[model samples]
Each structure stands twice: as structure tokens, then as C-alpha cells.
Target: MATTNIWQQFKALIPEGVRVVATIAANNGNGTSQAELRDGSVITVKGETVNVGEKAFILDGEIKGTASSMAQYEVEV
Candidate 1:
């Protein structure tokens, strides 16, 4: 299947009000970071973090909260 189609299918599986934790894939160093969601969508988050691989709870293009590491955040999710 095509990648876009596959992503859509994965997104459909997520129920409403269920928040997904995304990892900070890349930080632009300009108050923005590229976050990779569970559905494979890259969201632009406005935040400042020296930790590149940190996990964060994002909603509507904003970082609501963050964790020390991905493993620690995954436990809460």
C-alpha cells in the first residue's frame, strides 16, 4: 500500500480524546521542532529544548508537557 494510505489507516485506529506522545525528531534551534506522531505525521511544535530525542505531549501544534526521556514518557502513555 502507499505510505499516505497507510498513515491514514493508522490514524483512523486512534480514538478521539486519546492523546499520542510524539518524539522530538529535530529541533530547528529557532523555537520550533519537528515532532513525529504515531500516525507518521510531522508536526511543527514551538518550543525550546536542548534535548533532541525528548518525548513530549503535544496538542494543536503546541508542546503541553515533556519528559526526561522517551522511555519515561512512554510509561505515562
Candidate 2:
């Protein structure tokens, strides 16, 4: 008998949504920031001070929900 890994089997359970992989290109230093995504699209987020060069996840050009630092989702797999 072999043991099965539940994580591997359930990994697909993660919902697929609009996930933007981008880097903070600029910060206005006034609660506004801009990120340049891999797809060559720039999105703006206000009320958040994202440092330049910092990787971030943004959805719908807002960081209110479904957004956070990329480091937070790092998985040691």
C-alpha cells in the first residue's frame, strides 16, 4: 500500500481567478502606487504604499481584497 498526499490531490481545489504577477514600479509616497505586470499592463492602487521593486499581487487594480505581498504566498515545495 502506498500513502497518497492529500495536498497534491487537492491542489486543484484552489480557485482560478484573475491573478496579476507584477512588481511595484513606482510609489507616489502619498498612499498611491503603480505596478507593472508581466503582461505589460500597469495597474494603480491607492491607499497603499507599495515600495518600488517589491513584488505584489493586485486584483482589479485595487489592493483591498485578494491582494498581498508575493512573499506571503511563498510555498516551500
Candidate 3:
């Protein structure tokens, strides 16, 4: 018989989600809104609390909450 390892068991549970910063582009006027990432790519996220032209934190295609306007920098070693 096969055995389930710790890593396998962990995978079964709800894993952590990845959050990204984005700016509100447009509001669908329902419960979702359009947001734009730093890369100039746009994505639809769920949330209308944040106004247009504002930054927010998106996770799992849902809006967790508003985000700061601090600048971001990529570093390489």
C-alpha cells in the first residue's frame, strides 16, 4: 500500500495565498472592479471599497484590502 507523507498531507489543506499590489482602474458597479498592476497589466478583482486610481492588495482574484502607494524596487544578486 502507498503512504501519505507530511508534504502530501500539507498539500491537501488550504495553502497560503499570494498577494499582489494593484491599482483600481474601473468599477463594474456590482461587487467587482478592474485593477492594473505595476507591469501595466490589468486584472479584474472583487472589491469596490477602494476608489479608482488607488492601490489595493489582491489575493486569489479577490481584493483583500487597500494598499499603500509606496514605490517598489526589484533587486538582483
What TM-score quantifies how close candidate 1 is to the native fold?
0.54
54 in model 1: Cα distance from truth in Å?
A: 1.7
**Prediction-by-prediction clash tally:** 0, 0, 0
Better of 1 and 3 by TM-score: 3
Which model scores highest in TM-score? Answer: 3
The TM-score obtained by model 2 is 0.49
lDDT tens digits, residues 2-77, model 1?
Answer: 5678788899898655455788899888888898876788888877563567788776676767854534324553
Ranking by lDDT: 3, 1, 2
Clashing residue pairs, backbone N/CA/C < 3 A, model 2: none
Could you estimate the TM-score for every candidate?
Answer: 0.54, 0.49, 0.74
Candidate lDDT scores, in order, read: 0.73, 0.66, 0.88
lDDT of candidate 2 over 1-77, digit per residue (tens):
54388886687678655666577888777777888876778877764545677676666665443244544344697
Better of 1 and 2 by TM-score: 1
For model 2, give the 10-residue run with minimal summed lDDT: 64-73
Segments in model 3 whose C-alpha atoms lie over 4 Å from true places = 1-15
The residue pairs found clashing in candidate 1 are none
Judging by lDDT against the true structure, name the best candidate. Answer: 3
In candidate 2, how many Å is residue 46 off?
2.5
Q: State the lDDT at 31 in candidate 2.
A: 77
Q: In model 2, what is the error at residue 69, expressed in angstroms?
A: 9.7
